[model samples]
Target: MLDSYYLQDLDEEEKAMHEFNKDWKLSGIQRLFYNSLVKQLGGFGSEAGKFIWPTGVTNTLEGDLAIKDTGNQQIQIFSLDGYHKQTFSYGSESTKHLGDVACTQEGLFLVSDGSKGIKVFSKEGEMIHLLKSSKADWKHSYGLSVLKSNRIAVTDWTDGGKIHIVGVDWRMNAILKTNVIDGLQRPEHVAVTEDEDLLVTEGQLFGRNAGCCVKIIDSERALKKTIGPTYGDHYSFMNPSGICVDTSGNFFVADKGKNNVTLFSRDSSLSELVVTQDLEGPSGITVTKNGLLVVTDCYHHCVKMYKYRQEFIY
Candidate 1:
């Protein structure tokens, strides 16, 4: 028989014993570790009447804002003035985990459900199509970005790692000629450059500390260059998650480990910290048409809006 006990009901000694158990399953141990760490950091439990943890944020063509509430397993839409409009939830309340989201020019919404590949919906929240990745090869879909040609690029974190470029046609199938790009280690998020190059934030999984970095690759899937934790003596990044490029080719990276956003020039010559603090686990980032910056605060359970300072021009 299986025994169930709530960790919150356990005393200090019981909790300590749970942590030191060598024979306990690794998944259970990791859960205990996360719980203990959250408690120690004073960030355990819910946000208490606030918005749930938002993992992805995007602006629709109609200027509405859509946010993925990972904790609540729903997508909340809001007006530009921060007024809640509507929300959509899928699957059982206990099992839904929305990973990332993006909006296309045609008023279509694309969302990744970690295990369920990608789901496309209309602006009114109507289910249009479902694009499933290869279970034999692609395991988990973590991030997604839509290109101007109606092709969607997705980051899969199953085996080794790869990016699946799918054509959003009537059947929502992947193009055979331009399919997968190999050679990535736990790629979480993806950003495209002005010249059509791809940038990916890699190596930030649980238990594996593989020195996170960003990789720039050409259309042919050749690694042109890699920017590791330290570009020079002055700056570095840890567990970088979301990445986006502005009109001028400058890159903005959300470093969740450091809780700051770092701006990098196109030539990789200059890097500086742009926004820091008042952020709890910033995961995804994007620039709107009006030049405002939007970020997802995974732990704080809200999307933050930041305006660029007058002196800092793109």
Candidate 2:
């Protein structure tokens, strides 16, 4: 549902005016227009399509999407527009439980599978390397992200949450968890920002501390800011399960309990619900280079795509 009038060819003055009107808080007709602009583009891997317990989703360097189907024990690939592309089957003893997926700039897929640590796969779906932490007792590898430097950041969903930094060596066929950030509650997913800071979704699984939140940790491993537990009076998260950052530094989070996706400004000064409907349990989330928002709904057993950025529309 595009505002085709805005999509029409406009004069330089109109284009400039549209740019000026962009990037602000939406309200009234503007909110309605924003709603229409951010629409469900397409979906794939539904329950009827034979996909079950799809947990993780990430954008590949080739602009495609890679999804981790935990129940089906396979990695499914799709176009940015949600068209079926390819599938990588994995049922080996090592990759018995796939959790989250992240792709490196070199087109390598890093998959998280509990105690098996992380498995590295080539673009052609060949297993290349296995990553395990020698320093810390490896427990569960849940969420994952690839940094600008090609290093990986993944969360451990054990009792004491941990974010492990993994180093890759393709030539040596060696990948190792090099560093660890300790002292998180139950970090479910993680995303690295343009500045190399980490945004981790963590909270207690139950009780009063169940107020799940996203923590912004600096490069030096210091807590910089925390968003949620509650935003204003209308927003409260049950589970902030998945997170991803956009080119503009704004981050989007998929809340499984709330069944919605929320956008947070880079500075953590503002937030808004971008996709508020039709999600049963959105888990893994990723934003493509072109700003397409992809979310995996585990409960609904489908991967949904949406046009997320307003500037991308104007």
Candidate 3:
């Protein structure tokens, strides 16, 4: 897609923003001087909220939202209005840092951490069951999504990683090392459509095919299509990691490499890039019913929510 942010035609608003960011890109002593100076003036200032290296975020069962604050080693739940409700903390350490989070149909939360496993918890933050690493190969699992059968899927990007399909209650179902459609290469994040279909973002692909893509599969695990660079502007990904499917079937993906997310239609017929400002290496992402995009940035030490292509009919 043609990014308005980089168009040579350069609109006034775009030029202003471009110039500002160009100046904001400081380093070494310049960065230190800028920070010190900004702090003296009260602060460099923040938009609304700041999250510590947040890696994942998703919509709760009741339509609320949750964020994985990897930098702080905690999971924070917030109301749609931005009110912080609850937080689950893990010890402060990157090796065991939280990676992803998702809400089940029953209102439960499934979270993955750097400890080589997944953990189930109540909405209120009580620990439920720990999905041990022995259950699947995605030790240090990086992605998660609850499938239509109530089953959950997690992805591992280790040497020769694979997607492990577990039961609805979080037990092993199918250990797919091969592909039913396009070879499942280094699956990272996943989302389930209203029809129980699956969409997985491939992270290990490089070069011409560029691992920046997603795979479609049926509820029964049948591969549907490989929606990647071949789909033209409507389909392209650069280090696409995070994803979430909305009620209407359309989904959003965070392309951390490109610092943007692409919204694809239910039928894979259309796409649009969004949230072109203040997103620094965006990783995990999700969309609300009101059409707001909530995402986390690995480099910016914050989480953000904003509006994106909401005019689409469905």
TM-score of each: 0.76, 0.82, 0.74
Q: Candidate 3 at residue 29, lDDT?
A: 9
lDDT of 1 at 193: 80
**lDDT scores in order:** 0.66, 0.72, 0.63
How would you encode candidate 1's per-residue C-alpha lDDT over 234-283 as one tens digit per residue? 45777888888765677778988888777666766555555665777888
Predicted structure 1: lDDT: 0.66
Question: Compared to the true structure, candidate 3 yields what TM-score?
Answer: 0.74
For model 2, the stretches where C-alpha displacement exceeds 4 angstroms are 1-50, 92-98, 208-211
- Looking at model 3, the pairs that clash are 116-140, 150-168, 205-211
Clashes of 1: 0
Q: Which model, 1 or 2, shows the larger lDDT?
A: 2
Weakest 10 consecutive residues of candidate 3 by summed lDDT: 32-41
Per-model root-mean-square deviation over C-alphas: 14.1, 6.8, 10.1
Q: Per-residue CA lDDT of candidate 2, range 1-314, in tens? A: 33567537657653443342334343111331222323332234434234777788888888888888887778888766556677886554344433688888888888877764678889999887777645644587778888888888878866678888777675675664478788888888899988899999975488744748999999888889887788743577877888988777778888888788887767766666677767887888887777567788777777777765554531
Of 1 and 3, the candidate ranking higher by lDDT: 1
